[model samples]
Target chain A: MGRWEPNARERLELAALELFRERGYDGTTVAEIAERAGLTKRSFFRHFADKRELLFSGQEQLTRLIAEAIAAAPTSATPLEAITAALTALDSIFDDERRVLARERQAIIAANVELRERELLKGTVLTTAMAAALRERGDPEPVANLAAEFGGLALHLAFTRWIEPKAGEAYAKLAHQAVDELRATAAELG
Target chain B: MGRWEPNARERLELAALELFRERGYDGTTVAEIAERAGLTKRSFFRHFADKRELLFSGQEQLTRLIAEAIAAAPTSATPLEAITAALTALDSIFDDERRVLARERQAIIAANVELRERELLKGTVLTTAMAAALRERGDPEPVANLAAEFGGLALHLAFTRWIEPKAGEAYAKLAHQAVDELRATAAELG
Candidate 1:
């Protein structure tokens, strides 16, 4: 719990998201984010490569979470099952408090084409990593690739649905529902 | 036949690909591409919104093609079936010469992350268009989305294999192989 306390990186991320939402991604500056977080610009640079990285550093964490989950799924699990498990595992990281920040991040991304591209790239990177993890779990080539990509799509759908103003439903529930819909879609296609 | 015989737009696209490959995407300018194509800078702007648009102008045609194919597919066709039909129909547009150009474009994009993001965005836009078209054709929400997103994944896999240096293989054949693998993966998941 002590380790969970706000550090320089955490403060920078929160401050950057707030500033990006208020002033727009392009309209804001690294100095502003650092100053808002009560940190130095040098600390901000040490925490992130650039402004884009500020918005996208979570992608690194996402890849780590999904790849780790896929690697940990039972060897007997099918590729799709592994992907589902991996995605479901990610839902815990986005608690109710984080959901608000996630929604604002989505809104900021939606308003900026550059940010949207970064978002898509992040998804692509995660899918690619998940596929590799599945392969390490003994899944074959194209099968692992397809399953990981479909999982990415399922996550995208869940994120879209989860961000809407709703009751106290957890993102994990929404994500699981989206995965079920994906399975149904596959069944229909089959 | 005359209009098809290398208009300014065509010349610019060809010239731009060459220059991009030689000098890198960021190293080249509209003026350089226009001069190389023996056209004025105004002519380049008339055809594309920006330098990035020159590389992605084909996305407009792709959206139109896939959407029209979905609309024109048999009413009884399943969502996946319609997407397959649409993608296969796209193959005829890529002749041997265009395949070479496509390979060059892929190489250029692979070397540049900025261009890679745009490429992903183009795929996303196409998938979204395909989903909307499926909806217009009476498919359900997540089904259309999942099917369309899967179709995009299939397209990605096929393009990856198709662009490989093979012995005079057609892009359509590679695409079919990828789609078959996608179907198998989907069935396995089901």
Candidate 2:
């Protein structure tokens, strides 16, 4: 148990997701997840604070990716353009292999109220981060906040479509389409 | 305890807020709230599922009000126009007296992660309700959802301003200004 294990974090995540799907999220325990992963509970705790953290461990990385992308956008880019760059940056993470895990994770979250709330909080945090990055690039308050919110909405729609069983479009493409649709929708608002 | 209590709900809410403000949310008990309200714990339970409900009991009513307002908008109204009507309808709930309570409530929620998560969930629920009402009025999916999100952002901005100590404008006015500001920001998003 004291010895280091290879791929311990990834193993715990897959095992936890499998257990959560087979048994309800509420019915699974850390000990069971560790057992399924063939790791010590100590190793499991080393990777995640709890079962929920296993599901959201990528949030911090995703937030940083988005913020950095927005920051790296050309200085002349509009708020929405900066947000589009941020969305495009996420394409690597949502590659085909991850789509399967994403679908499972969405189902697990949809079935639990606590997880849904946490997801909303995480969405809010990311949106705020995007806005902060935009502001740092010299966008005003209203533009930064509104663009961040629009970006959040586009990401949500893109993710929803990306997880559909019959969906074939790339994440970046879906995200671009979502943003264009939002732009059209915004233009038509009376 | 078995007899009916006049304004029992309101009394309980006030008592709960006071206790929460004085002792902090986690330190206050339903029994203490009930006692402070000059009522029994049974009366408290009869009005609210728990102490958290005391803070969010208005969510259902607010959701219904916004949805109904959107439904009642003129047939020729655009999605954003209908959303505007819904925001104006909330003016009744944000009168000057309620502003004081809202300020305290916001502080309480800001200080606690659990409460903040619940608040975000409630906000999402209200936004969903607004979008559904817009859909029922024949706005397509994208328009309905985007308009509802805008309406939510406006409501958030309006509420934040309305709770400020120096805020002098009516809630409806603040709400209208927020929507207009969002529209301007959207137009310039490029």
| Candidate with maximal lDDT | 2
**Model 1 Cα shift for residue A8 (angstroms):** 1.8
True contacts kept of each: 0.56, 0.74
Please identify model 1 stretches exceeding 4 Å from their true place. A1-6, B1-6, B24-27, B167-169
- Model 2 chain B poorest 10 in a row by lDDT: B1-10
lDDT per residue, candidate 1, B48-151, as tens digits? 88888888988988899889999999998988889888787778776677877888988898898788878878988988898999999999887888888788
| Candidate 2 docking classification | medium
For residues A136-188, could you state the per-residue lDDT of candidate 1 as single tens digits?
87888777877887888888887777778774678788788878878867778
TM-score of each: 0.89, 0.96
Best by the TM-score measure: 2
Using DockQ as the measure, the top candidate is: 2
